[model samples]
Target: MKKFGIGQSAARFEDRRFLTGAGSYLDDENLPGQAVGVFLRSPYAHARLGGIDVSAALAGDGVFGVFTGPDLRAAGVGDLPCMADAPNADGSPCYKPPRPALAIGRVRHVGEPVALIVAETRARALDAAEAIFVEYDELPSVVETGAAMNGDAPRLWDEAPGNRCFDWYAGDAEAAAAALDGAAHRVELELVNNRLAPNSMEPRGAIASFEDGRLVLRVSCQGVHYIKRILLSGIFDCAEEDIRVICKDVGGGFGAKIFCYPEYVAALHAARTLGRPVKWVAERGESFLSDSHGRDHVTRLEAGFDNEFRFTGLRVSTIANLGSSLSPFSPFVATSAGVPMLSGCYRVPAAHVRVQGVFTNTAPVDAYRGAGRPEAIYAIERLMDFAGRRLGVSPGEFRRRNLIGAAEMPFRTVLGSTYDSGEFQQILDLALERSDRDGFESRRIAALQRGKLRGYGFASYIERCSGGAPEQARLIVGADGHIDLHIGTMSNGQGHETAFRQILCEYLEVDPERITVVQGDTDIIPRGGGTAGSRSVPVGGAAIAACARKLIRVAAGKAAELLEAAVEDIRFEAGRYHIAGTDRGLSFAEVAFRAAPQGGPAFDEIDEFAPGQATYPNGVHVVEVEIDRGTGVLDLVRYTVVDDFGQVINPDLLLGQVHGGIAQGLGQALLEDCHYDPQSGQLLTASFMDYAMPRADDCPDTDFSLRLAPCKTNPLGIKGAGEAGAIGAPPAIMNAVADALDADHIDMPATPRSIWKHLRKLAP
Candidate 1:
């Protein structure tokens, strides 16, 4: 077999179906006897459910069943379980709120599911849902992160006091304070990472059925096995083996479709009670209210620098607004996701971070494209720019002086993370070169002549991926020389089929066309972690490689037997096994034919590759922006990204991931914000008309490239590339806007009103 070196640009193999509109999305599936399920949700953010009268809906013409909270509880259903269980700073366990599948005595947030109505069609289900009446006693709500922590706010849970879910701290506070006191210069700023919705092109949908004493479910999810475990064992009070889950071709997930939602459990329970299939599809409006939102952190940051612009210390206190009910991964997002990566790619001598996860009256917040890393990068990079302004230094020079050098491989940080490998300076240099930093003054002058204010900004970011315990894979050789590979990782439009096929072909010396990759089914690939935390390529791909190697070993033995040669003398290459000293060789197909009729040399192998640690992938992004000083509108002019994703397996796919991530990151920084009315708690930005999404015209031409460092932790020599763009994009664009305005502070989504207000304040 030949080695497929790092940084090779192989075209994506999944584009054919996607471009042809043949992608098999969950909504496209129509079971023979499927009934549509619609949800009746709460209108008020906080309210006591006085009564629910589903009798009218149950007796309607097309209504098959109407399930409420009481029905779910009567059938022995449990609340959804939170994944992470981190402790607070005072050594007490973090608050664990019971997230019931259906609203119990009270509803905590608007759009909280209260009842499920099943009918023959989607329209009928929706009509019946609206017909069901419910009475509520409205209660005061808290929608702001800082306000939620105030004593006047209403408590959302008894387990959590003062509406505080968790008060967590990382790094050495005393050392950070001491360094700050003795620093030559210091700067402080306040930032808000606004809330964003993961509007995957296709909204979430599910189809569930009960047959032959087992429950079968199909969803558009990133983690099919995890959903099965949560529903069958945790919530449904059934044996894990009795439930089967499958995720077909998903349009997109972006970390929003990774969990078990209430509708999923309701559909399955409805199927069990009615003895038929029940299907549910969230409309765009319902999706905006139900899908897990991202970011929403209010932070105060202070940065200390020496005389030479070297970063000395940093301090950050963030209040994370995790909506009314805790999302599955909220704890990890607030503490592990953002807090650990606060330093980004810089080498700060000392740093301290405190995160208070607070409850808000909105949709639950979880992982989006970048998850917590975007919030961290926004804070650190913005502070870096402010520090540079205070010290009268260029942003580039200040960052270059403080970035982690290439010599610091496997460097451990004060926050307790071991960066496996990265060349931080190399990326920064590449980004700067690609962005044409030297000629930016001319561009700004040109823009100024057109009555536009032009500015340039740069952000260097580092993130953790391929973390968690382990992943498993199974490799099987069929009778006709076809290869079947099974893994536990699910792909929701990340091109796992194409990229994984390349790895299997490179390792097994088999034709890519003959290899088949299957995933997102619990019954098929049992005992493996589902994909998240960007662990698929590095961790999951490594497991596949290990399984392929074992299969090759077994095939080599069979080839040796057929060729009348010693097993030690046989060498397999180019799909054939040859003897070392003789001109005798056997093709893999021929060897398989000879070994078959006797189980084919036990041609089945399973591998559980556990690295037991996470690898950090870092990069640098430079962006140029043109701000209309009069109108206060910012438009992107040029964007360049140089990322070090360790070794890239498929260059084309890696770049695609980077491009999509950057667009999302840019959206969060400038346009997209999930807004709610402070007084009424009504979601104001509900549709495309109100919500701002990045269109083709909105994104500037992008220049993207990769640098290779080859992480030593995984056998594939690859790190995760799923979320790097989102992590690094926001800070770069925001910093560029701040540079153009010459302003002391600016919030995200710098709308015209906000920018004009800042400009007016700067006026004499």
Candidate 2:
């Protein structure tokens, strides 16, 4: 138990089945009398639905149903869900457009579901969908964020004119403007946070069945209870208790699989009508066109500095592209969570922020990886470097001077977010030391001799994590010998089994091998928020520890009765309860075995059901790059990261999370970009062949360290590490690329083509 305890680096117990290819993903499931479901997609981005030809597919063999939007509506199905509309500063509700499962009168985006074709086989479903065609009257499409916000832009929703959902503001505008008006120095930069596909290893899929008025859902997603809630309460308008959800071994989510899609709801309807199970799986191409995208933003930032070289004020105006329709948490991602990230780890007192959530003809945008924090950090960190260039100061030194010092614990920002705890300067110091910043000048000279341009960049990021609505955990010490823990948070390949087991071992003094962790099932656990925003460890694990503690207390009482000793005189140590004055003790398993036959099962339960604020996980990253001036290719020579993720649960698992997150961030910085044709509103980067993803060869060995700064809110003293790497990586790499080119700025995905163009402009 000691070797597999909290600080120990225990391997994931769930990896055995995964390695042997025995994992049970949604696609692996084959239910009784199951049929495959496929959707007919719109070819044009904006078009009127004029369809009357479904007889051909309906007459075909093995076609259970060819349900269109109107057919589904006639069957009493509800529209897809949206975020609860919030009031603006002027006391008006945010515009919310109806999101139907299938297209009715009009299709807003190219991949909008138009019809459902259910057949005995997937091939038949595909064939039937192709046979059923709908006539389209193509209309002008608004493809770009800027174009969508134009005064004369084509409207995507009648309720949201000019494609604007909400014009939201944070902080004090007058204070920021006045400070800028009298500042000693000021800088403004316009930038774009490129759109990205989540690209989870397995494309999204779902299986749904309705029997005896109970709807059962199985999906490869980040949550199980969340799926059940959406289906019962939001879509079908049924009682919440009539639905069961199971998520067994999801390949990866990265925030993409958190919402309820049209196919899922339609599958449930198909099951009810056909009286059998209906399954749907997205092809890789379909996933590219349909899945929620991330970080499509065009922002303008103004930063003001005083005569003493201190940051005085800041202002930001961001036009966030929400694509054709709003997802469940899209509004929060584009504005609510994004605005507070503007200041990052720095102390910016006077700041004002405005976000315009716009609609474009593409897949809906929502949380991906770091979600809103990455976009905000990229803007603020880039602005810091941009200001440094103007003032003839090094980026690192400029950031060091402005970081929120350790003395300012629990500091509140102008945008209204409290940073619980951080050692910002300590992280930068560790990162600089690890990256060898003092000798960077010598390396620059060495690179010049080799005819390459070399430069270093810095990024410090802070993100809110680990506060979900509520999580539940139940611990049962059974009659036999083994113990079981049913938790609420679902794992999207984050090693929740190993990490949670570690927490249980440390808290209850139980053998790690004897405890089994179960998650992602709605029937086993009553209610859960479902995992996203890095809430698994801090919130979910804390719930486990609380339950274990309660179990220990109950067991101590039982042990006191068996040993003929007072409850106060019993001391528990390493799964054994001892009489305090003597060596006589009883094992926990023995106590459970005796207690169960006498009264009931030995168990404890806890709920993280109270309201709380998010825990902050902060970090610093330093990257050095060498660019080939002739070919404009860049080689990442060295990358170093230092994070303050509170106390470590399992070092190995957390390190793996850091590595994976950095790779995704680097992919966005140097390779990945989602492209939509401006004129035609068609997705150009629809597959891996066209879209760039970072490979193993593209990555360098990551150097990582930690400076412990335990969170004050959570009882376990553990913050989150899930999204830290993605939050800090993009800005660091982009800043290095710009530094190498000796330019003020450059856009993301610094491909050789873009780098070559920038280098050519510097010629002569």
Candidate 3:
């Protein structure tokens, strides 16, 4: 591989515009004569809708439209369809509740959109929205996941009795039971992976315009093509081609923007009815209420281990809180995203996992950064540490003993996942070396002198990306000698433009600047599965490379014809096509010119690279923390991560992704939680003042390295790196805290109060 531009830490090309405040996000876009829409949300978690008196709101000055559920229903709009579906263990279909764009006869959760008030100005629409009267007969609501599964709790969905969406389990149960019965030592722990708000810098927004019998939607979404299909076929009952979904410069998605929100439907409907563009931008509070929250699972785990600290079997029964109506991807999240990755990087001989997707009176829980992998990592790694203490083995040594070895290539776990490739011990060794695990006792002693507890934590985690499905790309070499590559995957902050450009430049041997990457426009790009599950590089990047190769072939053939040489005799290298034993050659630009007839190139090609299966990216993370015993305030001093992402496309962007993911994971481990009052269903932490997001000062200096275990699945050998940091960081941080206090257990968000309470319990 060339060294100049392919693998180096090139500074991001998009950062200059973003840092200078010149980036154009959806909210920054303003159409001529655009009206603002403010949604009227339900305050009660469960309530019967008696009636909505919109007369006063309609009388408000500058109010153009007030749309409710009945209006949408009358307009022939259908409920948003769940994009992902999975069967139960018994082969029965999973329970899927109808998710209406606007609340129909009942409101199942707080902040459920009931009506949209469109006016000439944002403030006016908000004022009109406040004036709308909604009469509701409040019903008993269940906010807790466990309680929701009980018979006493009021049912949120009749189809799913006891509010249980599915009783799904993975792995061999009988074998796992037998292993547990014969194990030398057993350990059990109850854990909670707390719910979290994505809280991307820019809130969700949508601008809709209808003209010439066509609907154009510009929104802050991760999947524009997917959203177009959903809106046209599901929501508006229009043809997919009749609607164009354009996501222009999204601020950040982090899995929150991957779903179809009610605001989008409302904005589009308002524009169609009013014959003018309508815009709706969610406020910070609205974003907190509406955007999908992630990782609310109450799990009880039991692990069986032998005398040598080898894991024998594991059992986990978890209640996943899928709030109110199902989010677009809720079913898949519970079944596939949350369940498939239960076995982390360990070689457990047997395992059984029963995940019950339950309905609660709260915001819907969906994929966050690491999605299910983080929760699974927390459970397995915490149990590993606990087992280590019980077995009198060091945490690092215990992990090394049980980690899936390199010889276990194409290893299939009891949990039904075939890990294509990994070197789990290598990453752990690298992480330990980077963190200097041997010198940790001295650091703990130094911290103890200052009345602090210092400890280190380790986690070996694995994740599968590029698993969702196939992705498509279209690339063409234009007459101007520049290549235009169009892909269906949209970029939120992963630097797709720069990363994909590098792939194209490497394959085509063209200058990076000559390749123009286009994305997020449904009209231009072909069919594709949008970016999530860290599938962009292995799936989408491969698709882009496939297209580039096709373009090179076409260009080479044209050059052969122009040079009057046999196609096989012509060789293309470094953007030039030459004949064997001849100095006569044609530059890429000259070849493109020769291919062009009176108007343009003779042929334009598109390539769809379909991958067989997902690639597994595994890693180990070591976190060191200092706890102030007096104040119970924990400080993350250092975080070291060694990941096996198969191969590196861009080291700088990959590191940035790792850093950002660690921030989110650390927030979940020590700082962030979405708290709601059980009685009122009122959100306790709705703003930044209450929700503690990790800032620059909150994060420690990170040490990161990649273990080069190239995946054999993809052509580029790149596994997913987007979610690895989040998956590994949580366990590492939690383990470090537990090690610091020498405590047996600590809940997530190890808030100061929780830590203080644990300390009190531990003290004599």
**Number of the top lDDT candidate:** 2
Backbone clashes in model 1, listed as residue pairs: none
| Stretches > 4 Å off in candidate 1 | 1-8, 598-602
On TM-score, the leading prediction is 2
Worst 10 residues of 2 by lDDT: 602-611
Ten residues in a row with the worst lDDT in model 3? 1-10
lDDT of each: 0.85, 0.87, 0.85
TM-score of each: 0.97, 0.98, 0.98
RMSD of each: 1.8, 1.4, 1.5
Off by over 4 Å in 2: 1-3, 84-86, 598-600, 607-611
Write the residue-wise lDDT of candidate 3 on 352-457 in tens digits: 8888889888998888887777888788888888888877899888888888888988888777788888888877887888889889889889999989999889
Instruction: Please give the TM-score that candidate 2 achieves against the real structure.
Output: 0.98
Question: What is the RMSD, in Å, between candidate 2 and the native fold over all Cα?
Answer: 1.4
